[model samples]
Target: MSLLDEKQRGAILRALHDLRRAAPARPGEQYGAPGNGSSLLLSLVTVGLVFALWYVATNVGWIKPLFLPSPQAVWMQLMDVASDGFADASLLSHIGWSAFRVFGAFVLAACTAIPVGIMMGVNRVARGVLDPLVEFYRPLPPLAYLPLVVIWMGIGEGSKVLLIYLAMFAPLALSARAGVKSVAIEQIHAAYSMGASRGQVLRHVIMPAALPEILTGMRIAIGFGWTTLVAAEMVAATAGLGFMVLTASKFMATDVVIMGILVIGAMALLFDLGMRWLERRLVPWKGKA
Candidate 1:
């Protein structure tokens, strides 16, 4: 070989050796993974940074107090609402009312949607009947249906609950159906080969397999339900966090408005955390290889 060709061959061999040495011990090997402690620390740092920014912006008068209240001002308003009450109802009472409406509608949606979704997945008739309806209303914004809901159900608790229920139902049902459709055909065949009855197969095989998806659907549904709360409470509500926020805004009670917004966000965060915890506990095998 010529001198340059010999040098090029040596360089290629060295590069291949280096690349092999740097490769993972096994295919798909993960490295430098952060532990739970690292994750928690990062979360805390992010929250601290956000609060610091908020403090600096308000304290430095970067934003008008009328438009953006200081964190301290919002905190004081929270204390006032807790003690003196907002619109003759305590903060706890408003929270309770909002929670009641959300959970009520959510539970109703879960009970109905899950079964309908399973039927849709398992039976062509059900799919043909319900899929069109679900697809139709799912795309429409909640506000589009609000006037009709109010006219039909009147401006009462029934209307609010129904509106929230409608908001939660479609996504949940679709999730359940998708879950059922995703069930392994081999699992169904195995159950049938073992002489398991239809009911037995559904209960033991289908339900467990579909539970993770159903729970995920529930989480998404609750989020939608919460989003619908302000719209629901706009319908003649006497006591709710939404009502409190809207009432405060009319008079430009900026602190109270910010406080109410914070309370709603905090509650939603807590509930979401609870749902995540439940999912981890109940669906331990989810996403496992």
Candidate 2:
């Protein structure tokens, strides 16, 4: 008995060792997963390389200053904008306006689209009704509808927000629908077997299962909101990063154009990072099959 017990324990230990060797610490992750530090270092290196290339190109006159401003020129313009303001508004005000427009539209879209998407995913009638509308408009560019929106809403903040909201809606809706549909049938069956009501199952299972996709949709929707922002702001008046960039372009202020572009990119990047952090917090089980 003692001998048998010893052999069993050795076998179990060896099996555990083999299992550890065969599987990644996080299942479905690559064998040599890069930690957050590694990813940050790589991102920094890439940014540094791009900056170096830009500096060298400008210094060597590979690209004309008019067409491609030097880093120093753009940086100087940034400082000027920060201190003295541009287009009758400070840099911070421009950012604030843009952020307001983008986030406001995004919030509205998420509120409406997520529910509509879930309905479409779960109900045949809802799918029939809304899917056609979404598909019909999804392929159309914001520019195509810009004039109509301006005519209807009359060059105000209402029109601008609506344009961005429309741009963000289809993607958010589609992502939610996909997420709901992707929930495992087995899970649904098990829930039913355990006496779960339809509402309870949805609340407890479907919503959680669909959350990652919904969050992903939110991220994509925000990106679309930003892309449509330039067009939306074009309708109107003033005081946004998009407006600053467009105004600069008309005056042939390439340095300001570049600065505005960099600022927009940085803000978008930061929002995306926030979305990623939110995803990790809300859907920790994602990609961890």
Candidate number achieving the greatest TM-score relative to the actual structure: 2
Clashing pairs in 1: none
Q: Would you estimate the TM-scores of all the predictions? A: 0.87, 0.90
Q: Model 1 off-target regions past 4 Å?
A: 1-32
Collision count for each candidate, in order:
0, 0
TM match of model 1 to true structure: 0.87
Tens-digit lDDT track of model 1 for 193-233 = 65556876687677877888999999899999988999999
Poorest 10 consecutive residues by lDDT, candidate 2? 12-21
Clashing pairs in 2: none
Q: For each candidate, what is the lDDT?
A: 0.87, 0.88
User: Where does candidate 2 stray beyond 4 Å?
Assistant: 1-30
**lDDT of candidate 2 over 1-289, digit per residue (tens):** 4675555445544543443355434552556678778999999999999999999999899999999999999999999999999999999999999999999999899999999999999999999999999999998999999999989999889999999999999999999999999987876776666555687668767888899999999988999998888888897668999999999999999999999999988989999999999988877667753
